[model samples]
Target: MTDWITTPVEPRLLRGALDVERTAHGILPHRLPAWARKQFPDPYLAMVEAQPSGVRLALRTRATAIELDVLPTKTVYQGAPVPPDGVYDLVVDGKLTGRASVPGGNTHTIDMATWSAVTRPGPMGTARFAALPAGEKDVEIWLPQTEITELIALRTDAPVATAPRHGRRVWLHHGSSISHGSTAESPTATWPALAAARGGVELINLGFGGNALLDPFTARAMRDTPADLISLKVGINLANADLMRLRGFSPAVHGFLDTLREGHPTTPLLVVSPVLCPIQEDTPGPVAPDFDAPKLRFRALSDPSDRTSGRLTLTLIRDELSRIITQRSADDPNLHYLDGRSLYGEPDFAELPLPDQLHPDPAGHRRIGERFADWAFGDDGPFAVSGG
Candidate 1:
């Protein structure tokens, strides 16, 4: 065996994460800040955000071979086929050059039928990349977007150092699991990552799965985070969680915007409603899983008649979001709104059906990412860069 140089993972070598917690076993990257994490202390958020969605290790090295020791906590839904192995995307000099994944780690199994769960421990595994070009180069190994990865060690044939920042515009985004890359094939394949790549911007994704409820702490986190462009994908989580009514959603959105404006007074801000979800389009929610079906599926349980009583629904949420942005944009020219339907509407659905009646599949993720890039970064788009 060739001698290898092992190095401790450092904060300066990480990108797309807000913070990194050095744990007893390894380094855990977090999408949310400590204060925000402390504020929302739900186990679900803690677990999901700690999965390091949209996070990556960036470095400059001449190493022809490298290895990363990681402990990945993978989730398994009871009765559902095992999820595909978590994938690590390797990008070199801004180009996707490779991919890798370790064999095993921790497992959390949940039974959607009974709402019960169990956790089982597993051993750390290593991901190895060899035969890389021989020369100093920028390299980024994007952590698995859907797995809670505890980075244990990094080893290479040569020394490694933090990659120099490219001075790209930073794009900060917040949303639900869709933005968190629910069904994406790999970390960089997540919609936000894909859009950031196409838009030529640095990304900091705050897409907490099932937790993007427009909480004040989330808004505060966004307000404090520096960014050249920002976007918020709202409504679906609120409705699915049955967290609020229309009466509260409007003000909540306004407050969220108000807080963000406090820190990003003139930064281009975009508000995008939920994409096409037929199950919740006209119907209200508190979506429930359909266990009877052979494959896992979801159905909204709230009554459509609840609309008259001020309950939230996709249609209502979209209308309210459009109105709020139109009213606020009159004085805040940097504020803009894009109907989520424009990104994935009925027509798109007819073309690419949502497998679970909720989250989009990988192809759907690509479609959303492409459309988002064209809409937000295209010429005449609000966030369009000069000559981009």
Candidate 2:
């Protein structure tokens, strides 16, 4: 091991987190505040929120190399082969400069066949980035979006300090796994990150895989956070989770917006619907896992005939969402709605089909990100920068 100076991870260096929890092993960053976390203590919620979707450590240093000791909680599907290792993206001076991953951490194995799970302990590991240019420059080590990471230690050959703030507008975004960088090539390549780069804004991602269920705590979390602009990508998770019916969804959505508006009455709030998921477009869900194939796939389990009974589907949710936003927008001009299909519609799907019949691939992510930037941050868009 190389001799190096170690520094404690401080709050000033962290971006995109609402709070940090000090654990016996290391510091765990949380996108949801402690109060909100306390309210919903399910293991699933804890896992996804602690994954640090868009969180990163930003600082300035002249060190030629840096290392971060992390304890990651990796998830494994019991019968299938292990998933790819989670990735950490290193950004230098606002550009993606490197990528790395630790060797081992904790593991949570789930048997889709039985819907049972178990947690096993794993050893801590280190991620090191070397060959950085020797000069005082800004560096951001973006944590893994798919793993629950506890930052153990940060080491460098030279002294490190908090980097100067860029004074960019903070854009708070909430969505599902797609927004959580699910199939993106890397952390910074997630659609939201890509849009932030193109829009010249700072990002605080509240995207939690399999957990953006319009929870009251989430809306309250969004209400309390500081943001110049805000967005909600609703539908897919709700449908897939089969969380509620159409009647319940409308009021739940209205109540969610009401809570957010209480804190940000005039803030530009954009409500986005679901992108095309051919499986759930018309079929109602509680999506079921198709484990027969080598690669795990999802199938909408609810019947089309069930729609009359108020079962949720992408088409039904999108229509209700558009109506809700339209009605609300008449009285609150700051509120706006964007049909998600506009971002990834039929034509795009034909070119870049969702690999698992759900989440988009890397190319699809790039396409969605670019399209979003053009529409949401364009000259006539609601989030357009002044004088742009």
Candidate 3:
């Protein structure tokens, strides 16, 4: 029998994380930098950023079998059914070869009525995968897209090393829950991930669930991160969270762009408006979950008439983003805009409606990914050949 070798999970073996924290349990990958985390230390932000949406361990090895120890913390809404365990994707030589899920882990339960949460800790678990063709190959362990995962240990039947460079462009994306892959089948099945695969670029997803409200710190993070391509899927969370009005929204958008330009003056930046969410299209938001339904559903709580004032709506946001992008284009040719409806609109809703009047189903994610690949990464797209 071959003796199993335990390897230290180093930073070089990981990809897509802006920072890695050494916790008492293990090394935790963080999408947001330390400064940003300190500035806006919202529990929700901490959860989503540490959830490792597009984060993965990239390494080279000839191991026939491997095991990873992790402490996964899954979020749960009270009264609503608990979601299934998150999946771990194993990709070898650029192909998804295996998938697994850790059996037991902590559960963070949230009470919707009071908007409070309590975490019930559980024992650590391991994800194991076996059987390889042979010879050294690049291996990527895509962590759970929604769960906060603390990587504890890595043991393999053979030695492991750093992954070889593939010279792929780094794509940095920031958005809301949809971009965070709500209801998507797996980590790689997310719209951004699928698009990245098609475009042949490295993905750094900053799509925090329910937290894409034009925060200056978030924009600063995007500015500081080294990325060949960058995109911002704006509006959904902004409207739903009802963080600001039209007056503040426009300036916030400008400030966000200003920060990005500070770090990358000429990088191809795409600002995407919100997709067609019927509930928020005409209605002002501050959306709330409707627990009356069997499955979780959300309804727009703000008044539609408030639009007459300075309230923010999906339509208003789209128009503002379009006008801003059009004006900014004169000075910055690299800056561009895409109506998110082009990715998912009424036509899409007719065929593939959002499951809970909020997030798209797996099919919708795939469709969005396919269309985005053609529109943004195709021959005539912005990232055509020399994206950098």
Candidate 4:
């Protein structure tokens, strides 16, 4: 076998990464450690949506390779008995590079650490580091089976740039499961990824699975981060978790935006309501089925008489948010609003239903991506396209 000579690294690699990707997996270990197994009693708990919920990093590199010092914003830990095992695919310059695996899917393997998880060998780890092929490059991170997470190359210095970079202006988005790319096939196919691609701009997604509840800390995070454009995909998580009432939601959204305004006073900020989800569209909240003790299953009881009690439909929330944005826009010209259905709606749901009835499938992600791109960056849009 002939030996392959390694390519030299370039100076451009030292700048912060031009893109990032999330490709995590769920592992159901055959053997569970006494201390690790059976963390959560429910079986569904074991499938803790292993996708990387959020990512933040300050990339640095020498003349050799790009350094990935990643800060995972959220990693779901269900406390199940057995840890899940799987590998995430990594691609650079439109080619498969290598894989990153969580051997045993240890829930505590990556504990609640604030420091970044630096994949020292860069996107492909150290195994096949030479495949990066030196020069202006286009990197894409693909999910194993679904399109739940993806990061596109905004800027690079590889041999060939398949996806060219626009301007430095970045559009940052924050949301719940939808934003987290639930059930989407491949990472690049997600709505946010699609939108960024269509607009040809960089993106910083802060979507957290089951975690977008108008949290003050998240607002602070947005305020503290740097961005040329900003948006918050709200309502779904609050409705799903049944965390707060309608009365509390309206004011909470205002507060969240207010906090971000402190940091992004002039930046265009768009607020997105929840996408269309039929199961709970009109239903006030989730009602668990009755569980018979003999079957070892728990059930939920919901009173049909109470419609508004549990239901926080997308239509209702979207309308309310629109009203709020209209009211606030008079004072804040930078504020904007977009209906969630514009991303995904009843028509799309009829074709691609979410497995859990709350999340979007891969096809649904494509639909969302297409619609969002058309609405935000299409010729008729209020927003302008960015090109470098």
lDDT computed for candidate 2 = 0.89
Q: List TM-score per model, in order.
A: 0.97, 0.97, 0.98, 0.65
Regions of candidate 4 where Cα sits further than 4 Å from its true position: 1-166, 286-301, 308-311, 386-388
Report each candidate's C-alpha RMSD, comma-separated, in the order given: 1.5, 1.6, 1.1, 9.9
Question: In angstroms, how far off is 137's CA in candidate 3?
Answer: 0.8
Per-residue lDDT tens digits for candidate 3, residues 1-388, read: 7589999887888998999999999899999999899998578888888889899999899998899999999989999888999999999998999999997888999898787889999989999998865888999999989999999999998899988768998999999888888689999999999999999999999999988999999999999999989999999888898888899999999999999999999999999999999999989888998978888999998778778667888998999999999999999999999999999999899999998999999999999988998899988787766542
Q: Tens digits of per-residue lDDT for model 1 on 1-388?
A: 8679998988888998888888878889988889888887577777788888889999999988889999999988888899988998889889998899887899989787675678899999998888888899999999998899998899999999998878889999999999999789999999999999999999999998887899999899899998999999999988898889888999999999999999999999999999999999988888988878789889888787777767888989999999999999999988999999998999989989999999998899999999999989999898898521
Winning candidate number (TM-score): 3
lDDT of 2 at 322: 89
- Tens digit of per-residue lDDT, candidate 2, span 200-268: 888999998887888999999999999999999989988898888888999999999999998999999
Each model's total of backbone clashes: 0, 0, 0, 31
> Over the full model, what C-alpha lDDT does candidate 3 score relative to the true structure?
0.90
Residue 215 lDDT, candidate 4, scale 0-100? 68
Residue 342's lDDT in candidate 2: 97
Candidate whose lDDT is highest: 3
Per-model lDDT: 0.90, 0.89, 0.90, 0.52
